[model samples]
Target: MIIDESLPGKEECVGSLKNILDALYVLNGKWKLALILCLVQSSKRFNEIQNEITGISSKILAKELKDLELNDFIKRNVYPTTPVSIIYEATEYALTLKNVIGELSAWGEQHREKVKQSMRKQS
Candidate 1:
């Protein structure tokens, strides 16, 4: 999907391809979509996210959160209270993704079922 100079008068098509790549740049990870779903459930602190998203290393979670924040998909609120505290919540932009994520999850489930049926038939 690399855009090249040969595609003359195709700036519009190139733009569309660029847009899709930008999207995949953010949501192109095993953990990112799941992390978004978890955040959709409720606003949470760093430790809370790490706990709820079992097996996620602190470093990886931090990277994912940073990526989401950069993508304008989540907001990080810092409280200047005791010991300093922060909470991450889905932004309005992120909220818009709820329906999309739901549909994707359903599709994944159905795909899994189909795969299982195929496996069973082969066995």
Candidate 2:
């Protein structure tokens, strides 16, 4: 919803709209945030991440990881080892989303309860 130029708070509204669109452009997927949340707790190998974030197939996880890495939200570290061990870690930039993630989690719980209550009332 783009506000008209004559509106009192048009500048703020347009700025906010642009900012939100930019954020959504970067974080517009089901798995990106979840993957980031998982790694933010601790770095892990490919399979480990796949296991922790259930229902995310290895193929999709790989793609999501690539996207996160490209966005500088995660780091892919390669260790010198017999089988070439590698781990995915959340970058410092990713930590900035901690509060956002927390808020979303809390909101999700609240929304779930609200939905449940609404359903109960309907019956």
Top lDDT prediction, candidate number: 2
TM-score (all chains, Cα) for each model:
0.74, 0.84
Native RMSD of candidate 2 (Å): 5.2
Q: For candidate 1, lDDT tens digit of each residue in 22-111? A: 778889886888888888899999999999999999999999999999998889999999999999998888888788798887897879
Q: In model 1, where do residues sit more than 4 Å from their true spots?
A: 1-19, 113-123
lDDT of 1: 0.88
lDDT by candidate, in order shown: 0.88, 0.93
Q: After best superposition, candidate 2 residue 121: deviation in angstroms?
A: 16
RMSD of each: 6.9, 5.2
Model 1 TM-score on a 0 to 1 scale:
0.74
Q: After superposition, how far is residue 10 of candidate 1 from its true place, in Å?
A: 11
What would the per-residue lDDT of candidate 2 be over residues 1-123, giving only the tens digit for each residue? 657756658889899999999998888888999999999999999999988989999888999999999999999999999999999999999999999899999998979988798989999
